[model samples]
Target: MVTNRLWRTLSAFNCSTRRWAPIPLRNTQSQVTQRLSPTSRKIDTLWTQRLSIISWNIDAFSSRPVSRAKLILSHILEGPKSPDILFLQEVTPDVRASLLDDARVRAAFLVTDAEDQTSFEDVPFATMTLLSSARFAFGLDSQKESDGIEGGENFMLGRISRVALPSKYRRDALYVDIIPPTAPGTFFRLINVHLDSLGDTLHYRTHQMEILANVLREPGCSGGVIAGDFNAISPEDDGLVNKNGLVDAWVALHGGADPDGATWGVGVERRNGLGPGRLDKIAMMGLKAKEMEVLRPGPIEVPRPGEEPVEIPWSDHCGLRCTFTI
Candidate 1:
C-alpha cells in the first residue's frame, strides 16, 4: 500500500538519462502555504470553494524551447496567486523534466504524468496536468465510493487515469477524480487535452471531442471540466461545446465572439493568413464560471547565451485562466 510519506518522495523523470530520480523534498508545509496569497486564503473560507485553472499550450516545438520553458514556468509560478490546477500542452521531454525538477512545483502540485511516464514516451510531446495538493484529495477508485481516504493531511487518495483519444497524431487526454473540499462523497473529473492540430484534421478533433463528451456523462461522474488547447481554427469548432452538452467557460463569463476571448496567434506572426482565434479553452458541465482572463497577454524577449536575445510570445498561443464554482 502507498503510504502518505511515500507520496512525498516525488519522483521525477530524467530526460537525459531516461531514468526516474527522486526530487529532494523541502519544508512542504511552508512552501505550499506561501503559494497562496492573502486574498486567496481569505477566499478559501467561503462555504463554496472555487476552482482556479490555467490552460496553456507552451509550444514546445518553438525556437529556444529550454529558455522558453523556463520563462513560462516563472510566469506561472511567480504570479500573485497560484492556480488550483494547471493544464499544459505541447510539453516536450525537456520541458517536462524542468517542471518536475522545480522544488516549488513539486511542493505545490501533484502531477498526473509523473507516475506513468512510459505511457507517453512514444509521443513527441504530451499534455500534463498539475492538481493543487493543498486544495484537493484524490477520490477512491470508484466514484461511487465515499469521500477521500482520511490519514495524513496531505495524503492523496486514489490515482489519476488517462484516455487515448482517436487521433492520427496519437493525442490523448489525462483526467483525475477529485473530491471538492466543500462537497464530500462526490467527485468531478478534470481533463487536460490537446486535440489534433491543423485546419485539415478537423475530423480527428471531432472524434476526440465525442469520446470526451461520453466520459463526462459516465455513470458516476458528477460533471467535469475539460481544459487545454482545442486548436479551434475553424468556424465549426464553435459548435462542439453545445453539441456535446458542455458550457464554454469563456462564453459564460464574457459573451460569444468577444475579441478579447482570442487566445492563439496573438503577438506572433503566422504564415497562414488566419488571424488570432480562441483555440485554448475551458469547457465544463455542472460548473459555473465566475471569472476568466487571458494569461501572458504580450511577448517577452528571451536572452540566449551567445546569440542575440530572441523575442517571442510566451508561446505561439496565449494561455487561458479561469475560476469556476461547483
Candidate 2:
C-alpha cells in the first residue's frame, strides 16, 4: 500500500528520539497506519450497515412547558449522530408540534393518555407526522391482552386501541421499531418503559417485569434492545432481574459497578442513597453494544445577559444512552 502525503506529514510531527530512545516519526505512522487501516475499514462498513437504538425519559410535558421533550431530544443529539431507534418515556401529546417541526429528523413517536379510551390519544389537534415517504410502516403498540405474558394481558404502547393489560396501571409504555432505509427489511425492536413508581402500593412493577421478560423471549424479537427508566436498581443489586442472556450495555462497557459514584441525594422526601438506586438503565438482548454511557450534564439554565445558563426545571432525571450495532 502506498502511503499518502498526509501520512508522511503526520509521520514527521510524530517522529521523535527516545531520552533513552526517541521513537521515529516514520515508525509511528507506519505502526498506526498498519494497525488502523483495517480497523477503519471495518468501522466504515459497520456504520453503513447497522441500526442503533436509544432509550430516554424526558421527564413529563409539564416539566418544561416551552419544550420539555424537545429539550431532551436536543440533549440526545448532543454527540455526533442521533439514535435511529429512540425509546422515549413520558412523551405527552401536549407538545408534539414542536418536536415534528424539524424536517431533518425522521421521527416516529407515539403518545397515550389515560383519560382517552381510544387506540390513540384524543388530541385531534395534534399533527400526524410523515417520518418517511418510503415503504416504511408505523403503528402504535397499545397495551393489550393478546400481547401480554401468559399470566397477564397483552400490553401495548402508544395511542392505539389495542388489547389491554389486566393491570390497572395508569400509564402505558411505548415502543418503536425502525427499518433502516439503507438496509431494507433489516431492523431492530426498541422497547421503552417507565415501571411503577417505588412509592406505589400495587404489584404493577412485578407484573411489568414479567411482561417485559416475556416480550424478549418471544420469537421474531431479535436484533433488538429494551431500555428506559427501569425505576429499579441494577440487576446486580436485584435478583428479580436476571441478566441471564441479555447484556447491560452500560455495565458491559463501564464494568458491572457503580459507573457514576454520585449519590441519588434525597429529593422531595426519598433517601435511597448511593447503594441501591439507579432508576435509569439501558439493556440489550441481541444487537451488540458499541458504546454506552449515562449523560448527566450540570444544570443548564436559560442564558442571561453575559451570564451562563443553568439546568432547566424541566426534568428531575438524567439521560442514559447506548450506541449499538445490529
Candidate 3:
C-alpha cells in the first residue's frame, strides 16, 4: 500500500511539471514574433536630425612662407558659426593639413586632383574641397573620373545611412546621398564647382555654366546645391544668369541684385578690395537659400603672431557663404 501511494504521488508531480513547463516560453513568444516581422523592424529603425549646411570658398592665392597660411587659417576658424559642410575653393593639398588640423575645425573630404596647393610653400591655385560633418561620409566619386574635366577626379562622399539620388539632370553631376540627423527620406546631394574665371572667354564661361546646369538636371541628383566662385559679376552679367531651375542665394538675400560680394574687383587689384571683376559667388539648386553672407577681410593675425592683426590681401577675392536649412 505504501509503494502504491508513492507511485501515485510521483505521477501527480509529473503532471504538475508538464502544466507549468510552457509558462516562460509563452511569455517570450510575443516578443520574438514582433522582432521577426519586417514591418515592425522597419518601424523600430531611428533616423538622424535635419541637416544645416555652411559653405565658403577661401581665397587660395595669398600664401607666402608664412602669411598666406595664417590668413587662410584665421578665416576658417573665425566663422560666425562652425560649418558642418565647408566647401572651400583655392585650397591646396599642402595647406589642407593646416585647415583640417586646426584645433577648431574637423576634416571630412579633401579631394585629390582638386587640391591645388599641397603645402604652405606651394603656389596657390584653385583647390576645391568639400567638407561634411563628422556624422556624414564623404569622398571622391572615382567611378565618374571619366566625366570630370581632363585630370579632374570625381570625388564623392555620403552619410553612413542609406539615401537615394533623384533622377532629373543628364550630365554626371557629383552624386552625394545625405541623411540628416533627424529626418528620414529627406536625403539630398551637393555639387562643388569653380566656373571659368572672368578671364576665360564668355563662350567658355557660358559653356561651363551650361554644363553645370545640365549636370544638376541629371537623374539621381534629387534636391542638391551647386556652390563656389562663379567669377561672374552678377547673373545678368552674362545671358546665362536667368533661373534655369536653381536659385541665386546672394541675389535673394540682398534684393534683386547687387555688386558681386567678392571684394576683389580685378585680378590685379586683389590686395585691398573687391577686384576689378566680381570673381566670387555662391549658387544653390533645388533648395531654398535661407541666409547668405560674404565673409569680408577682417583683422587676420599677420603671419607673425607678435605682429598686429592686419588685413590679408590674400587672394583676388573674398569668400561667399550660404547657409541652408535641410
Candidate 4:
C-alpha cells in the first residue's frame, strides 16, 4: 500500500488491496475558451508546443538523504533546460514531497502517481513516476488502471498494467497515455520501468522485458515510448530487455555504446557507482525520433550555475532526455 502526497500519489490502480489517499496536484491544463474578441476562437498556449521528454532515476530519499533530493530538483527544474514531459523512476514519498514543494517545479509541471509508493517504513523508494506540463496531459491518473478514459480513450492517457514478474518482486512499472495538446487525436504511451537489480540473472530480466513488450504491443496501439533504469549492459543479454522492435535512441545516435551513456553504477567505486554502465535509457515503439542526449556533466557531482560551494551529484545514474519531432 502506498500513501503519497497528491504532490505525488502512490497509485497502481490495480493495487486495490492497499488503501490510499490522492494528493491534489493542480493542473490547469483545461481552461475554458473565453471570448475576448468578436468572431474569434480562443488560442491554447500549448497548441504549438513541442514535447521535450526526460527519463531519470533521481536516487530516492529512502536510501539517499533529503538534501540530495533537493539538489536533484534544483538541477532538473532550476537548470536552463528543464523538461516538459518527464518520466522518473525510484521516487519515494519523501523525495516526492521535496519535488512537490519546489516552487519552480510545481509552477511548471504536474506529477502523476508513482508505482509502489511508500513501500519501506510506510515510505516509498525506487518507485516509478511520470510528470508533464500543460502541453502534455495524463489520460488517466494512476488510480484508474485499465478503467479506460472518460469521454474518449483516444483523448485520455490510458493506464497500463504490468504483465509478469518474479514472485518475490513486487515492483510495478509506470505507464500512461500522453495526449499532446498540439495533436488532439494522437496519443503517446509512456512506460517508465525499473527492472531487477544486479543480483537478478539475465533470465529474470528477460522475463520482465518480455512481459513489458507485450504491454507496449497491444492492439490498436499507435506508437509509444519505453524508458527508465533498464539494468542492461548491452542490447542482447540472453533476451533481457526484449526491445519489442523498439529503437534505442542512444544507440541510434552514437552508432554504438559510449561510456558516457552508462546509467548504472556498480562495484565499490567511490567517484561513480558500479563504474557507470548505461543502466538508464529512452527508446521508442512505432515512432520517429529526432534528438537523444545523455545528460551527465562528468563525474557524480556536477557544478550548477551560481552554486560554486555546492557541486551536486546528478544521481546514481545520469538522466536521459530526448526530443521526438513527430
Candidate 5:
C-alpha cells in the first residue's frame, strides 16, 4: 500500500524532460503507412494495425559486458523481423555506448538517453527505449498546426519523459509519447520500467506500479504500454496488472500464465537456488495484444583472457516480443 509519505516523495521527483532527441541519420527506408487511421473504411480494420514491441533485461552485472551486449544487439537488430519499439533494462554505460555506436541501430531507431548524459546517475544500470525512426518521422509530419498549440505543449515529434520512482535502488520509469500516424492529434505512451528487486520489496513495487498506472490514466493520454523487469518473485506480484487496470500481454494472448512463458532463472544459474519465474512482462491499456512470444537468443561463446572460450547466455533473463493493435 502506498502511504502519504510515498506520494509526497514521488511528487518531488516527478520532473520531466525531452529525452527523445533524434540521431542525425538519413531516412533511407520506406515510409511507414498510417496504422491507426481514425477515418478507416471499416471500424474492424482499426483493430488490425499491428505494432510490435520487445522488452528485455540485459543483465548489466554479468561478466563480459561487451560481448553480451553485442550478442544481444545482433539478435534484436539482425533478426528476421525487427520490432517497432524496444525496451531494455539493466543497461550499463558500456552497453549503452555499444547500442548508440551501432550503425544498424542508428539507421533504424530514435533512441532515448544519449551516451553523454547519465540518465540514472545514482544507479549502475538504466532503462533505454528505441522507437522506429520512420514511424517517428511520419508522426511528426502528420501533426496538425493546431495540435502543437494545445495546452501550450508541442505534440510535434512527440516527447520522452522520465519519472523517478520512490525506491532505494534509484529505479525510474521512462515514458515516450508516440503519435499515431493517422491520428493527427492523438498519441499513446510507451513506458520502460525496472521495478524494485528482491522478495522483501513488494510494497515498493506495488507503490511504483500505482504511480505508473496513474501516469497511464492521466488526461490526454489515449493509452499506454508498460514493459520491463518487474522482479516478480512472490505471489502478490501476479495481481498487479488487474489491480492497476492494465492487461498482461502474455496472459491476454494465451488465456492464462503459461509455464513456458517464464523469462528468468532458466538461462543462467542463480546463487540463491531459486527456479525460473516470469520476472519480465508487457502490460498495456487501450491496446489489443495480437501475439506474444519469448525471445531466447541462447548463448554465445566468449573467449577468456588466457583460456578456451566458454558458452553463456547473453543475459540471465530472456526477452519478450509482442504485437499490439491500437
Candidate 6:
C-alpha cells in the first residue's frame, strides 16, 4: 500500500502532548444540577448525574495528533469535569505508540489495548481502542450483571476483551466494564469498534453487524454502550439496530437534527475519495443521553500574536462525543 507523502513527512516530526491520567471511580459522586450546556462545557456535577461518552474514529491520529490530544483535553477531559468513559476506533499501532510515549496523552488516560503486543516491531492495525480517566474503574472482564470494578479514588485502569469480527481487515470490537458514578450498583458496558472499511459493500459488513448485534443483545447489557466508526451508511444500519433494540444516541438526541453533520465524509465527496456521510456513531440499549455533539478539528488560537500557527489538524474524518444521563 502506498503512503501519503504529506502524512509520511509530518509523522517524522517530533510530537508531544499532555493529558490527565485516569482517576479511579469512587462509588459516590456529587450531584449534577443542570440540564443542557455547551459542547465544550466542563463536567458540572451541580447539574445532574450523567455519564460522558466520547466516540471518535480519529483518522488514525494522522497529522498533528498532539493538537488533537489538546483539543480532547480542552473539550472532553477537563480535570474534575472529565468524561466517565472514552471509546476510540481506528487507533492504529503507530497511534498507540504515540499515545504510550507521549507525555500529554499519558496525563489523561490509562488506556487498555484490545490486542496485546507480542513483538515490539509488530505494527498494530486498525483497532477498537478503549481508554478511561479517573471517573471509572477498569481491567476486569465485562459482565451482564454488576461486577464491581476494583479501584479507589485513583485506581481506574483494568482489563478489556478483544472480540473480533468477520471482515476482510480482521476488525475487532473492544469491551470494558465501567461504573458510572451517578447510578449506584450499575456497571456500564462499553464496546468500541471499527467496521469493514475495504469498501461500501454489505456482504462482509452484514456478517460483522450480526456479530455486533448479538453482543449488544447479551443478557447483561442494560446500561451498555456500543460505539465507533461503523462504516454503516451503505447498509442503512437500521435493520440490525431494530433487531437488537439499540438506540442511536445521535438520532435520539437530534431527531432529524444537524443534517449536515458528517464524521467521515464531510467534504470528501466533492473531492470524492471517501464520502459525505455520517459514519461514526454511539448507540446504547438502556442509557439516556443528556447531550450529543460532533467534534471537529478547527484552529486553536495561541496566546501570542503575530506568530506562526503552532498546530494544524489534517484528519480526513471528524470526531463525536455524547454525554449520557445515567
Best model per TM-score: 5
Ranking by TM-score: 5, 1, 4, 6, 3, 2
Reference-based TM-score, model 6 = 0.65
Candidate 1 has an lDDT of 0.69
| Structural similarity to truth (TM-score) of each candidate | 0.79, 0.57, 0.57, 0.67, 0.79, 0.65
Q: State, as a TM-score between 0 and 1, how close model 4 is to the true structure.
A: 0.67
Task: Give candidate 2's error at residue 122 in angstroms.
Answer: 9.2
What are the clashing pairs of model 1?
Answer: none
Off by over 4 Å in 5: 1-48, 138-156, 267-271, 303-308
Q: For each predicted model, how many residue pairs clash, with residues at least 3 apart or on different chains?
A: 0, 28, 45, 16, 0, 26
Tens digits of lDDT, candidate 3, 106-144: 323322222222222323443334343233433223223
Give the C-alpha lDDT of model 6: 0.53
Model 6, span 1-326: residue lDDT tens: 11100000112123342222232332311111222221221222453446676776666545555555446545555545456566666565655565555443354344554123431123345543434433444433322112444423322232245554566766666666554443333344677777777455567666766566555444333346778887767545545555555688777778735675677656444544545667787878656877877777555443346776564344556777788764
Candidate 2 TM-score, C-alpha based: 0.57
Give one digit per residue, the lDDT tens place, for model 2 in 275-303.
42567666666557777666553343566
Best by lDDT: 5
For residues 1-326, write the lDDT of model 5, one tens digit per residue.
11000000112122232222333322221211113222222222343367789998999886887788788878987898788888999988878777766666665566676635457566798888876653454233323332453332222345556667878687888777765555545568898989999988999899888777777665556777999999888889988988888999998888665788889987556788888899898999888898999988568787798999888788988999999887
Candidate 3 steric clashes: 45
Q: What residue runs in model 4 are displaced by over 4 Å at the alpha carbon?
A: 1-49, 61-64, 114-124, 138-156, 160-164, 180-186, 234-243, 266-274, 297-314
Taking every candidate in turn, the Cα RMSD to the unseen true structure, in Å, is 9.9, 20.4, 22.2, 12.1, 10.8, 12.1
lDDT of 4 by residue, 17-110 (tens): 3333344332321211222222112224334434567787777642344566666656666677777667777776677656555555545454
